[model samples]
Target: MDQAVIPFDWARMLLGEEPPTFLLEILLRTIVIYIYTFGLIRWIGGRSISQLSMVEFLLVIALGSAVGDSLFYPDVPLLHAMLVITVIVLINKGLDYLILWSDKAQTAINGIPNWIVRSGRLNPDQTSDRGIGKAEVLALLRIEGISNLGEVEHAFLEANGDLSVFRAREPIAGMPIVPPHEICPLPHVEPSLREGEPSPKLCCFDCGMLQSRAETACLHCKGEVWTEAKMPDSRLA
Candidate 1:
């Protein structure tokens, strides 16, 4: 017959079915993984943790699983986890070298920086290709205290997922993104202006390209929807 269960078997609960010497093995296992992890991290370049590229991100995920599993699971041997970690780190290092030596390799693995905004207009092709929306770009611009797209000359979505923005020396009329579209929706322009009147500056709702109100559609995006282009508020500028 099976042994009766004991409710308050503290020794069995704490120590488990293994011998007390297994505690020593656990300690050794932890030390080895800790040292190996530390050494591998040190060997890797001192890039900011916030800026982890694709390969670095993969290294973190693999090491985290292997190290955590070996640390507590009695069945998992330290050497096995260590070997996995070593192989992953070696592959990561090799990829790093390849990235350094070959532009094509770097582009393939890390991705190329995409021009999200150029000449105060959103690059719809690049932004859509990168799976970035106008709202996201606007949020990043807001972080940089940009009130409107007119204030930006250029903005790039970096390979490491950072936004790089350059301010325009002479700002032009552009679509206002601040206060968000939800709070203050873009003001639509009337279809027709008075005869012989100068055309009002209008921007494509989709791509933010400035154009004359006389045009039926935006030249950049061929979008029919448009709103009055806003000049940057001097106070915000």
Candidate 2:
């Protein structure tokens, strides 16, 4: 039989239908979960909360539901929630230990850093494999105050999804990314130059590898498209 629903039931709203003794249990449950979670976080070391790994992300989702539901829901048994949290933390800790000891486990779980640029030339294979496009790389370079691809000697896509760039001590003439591609689109065709004439500073459109005027395809990226290489502006350096 269903009891009649009442409007503005103060006792039901304020205290819920759980026994008064459950309130004490709720306090103990909260304390235990909080302490246990905090201790586990400390054990996991001081990695920034902002940079949560895949395993840590799972921990956050599982713990958030378990802790929140166990706090207020009368039907959610405190012991069950505690056990769930324990198992989750244990799994996380175990993965951490495994990652520390095994290079294969660490690479599998967190991935390895990818070299996206080397010697002012883009690594097309690595970028394509990592699903990083040329536009994205250009944006990252611009964020680092790069005006041209030649300014970068080496650039790596870190496992944590951060781009690390190393600048060349003596910058070379490379493909310019300034003024943005949206504002000024790159040229696709090679410039016509007389035979025996020195190649007019042309670079491969795809990988920024310097190209000879006579070459139909880029030796590095095999891209036939060419754009005039821009010397690094002293003011922008």
Candidate 3:
């Protein structure tokens, strides 16, 4: 028979065969599947999609695909999809148990965190082992608002590929230690003015130059960037 202009086989389209119904059956299937999926996720724990670990992410993707296919495809048996979900959930649970109980298993599965930076210097061994370069490290530090490596006391590469940075409590004092070539005094302030003296000291940020008077331009390098050379008690790392 020639296909209808829109091929509207109401029975076959809605019910698959002539057995299940259109509005009622489809509605029931959607509700049941939704409830089941919700319960499964709840049992797995109340972690948001963003907070899901690598293993959990894969499980969510698999469950979503299986559930969606069974919900709308008449030829796909719901029971088969449910069975697959059950097996996947069981395996996930089993792996979680192993990871929790065995330290070696946990390391093997999730990997160990690498100390990318330590004590204001890049850990060359760790970076080389992980195939990370100086440029990549600098880029990540820049993203965290750290322009100078000396500002960071420590940095770690987490197992899930996130970078955690620990900043120095005090800015490292010396010229060329950090980038941009600005220098903090050896003792952080002039010794004569160190004891209870609020001196109006101005210094160039880009070039290491001690200025006697505040001017619109630096005398030595003519750089405009300048800051009062008062040492702070604490600096954010």
In the order shown, the candidates' Cα RMSDs to the true structure are 8.6, 8.3, 14.0
**Candidate lDDT values, in order:** 0.75, 0.74, 0.56
Sort order, TM-score high to low:
1, 2, 3
For residues 1-237, what per-residue lDDT tens digits would candidate 1 score against the true structure? 966757556554456567767756655664566546545543332222338776776688778998898677655555566666776677778889999999998876677777999989999888776667788888878888898898899998877778899999999888888888878898787545577888777788888898855777778888888887888882321
TM-score of each: 0.75, 0.71, 0.49
Residue 119 in model 1: lDDT: 84
Arrange candidates, best lDDT first.
1, 2, 3
lDDT of 3 at 235: 36
Q: In model 1, what lDDT does residue 19 have?
A: 74
Superposed by TM-score, candidate 2 places the C-alpha of residue 13 at a distance from the truth, in angstroms, of 17
Best by TM-score: 1
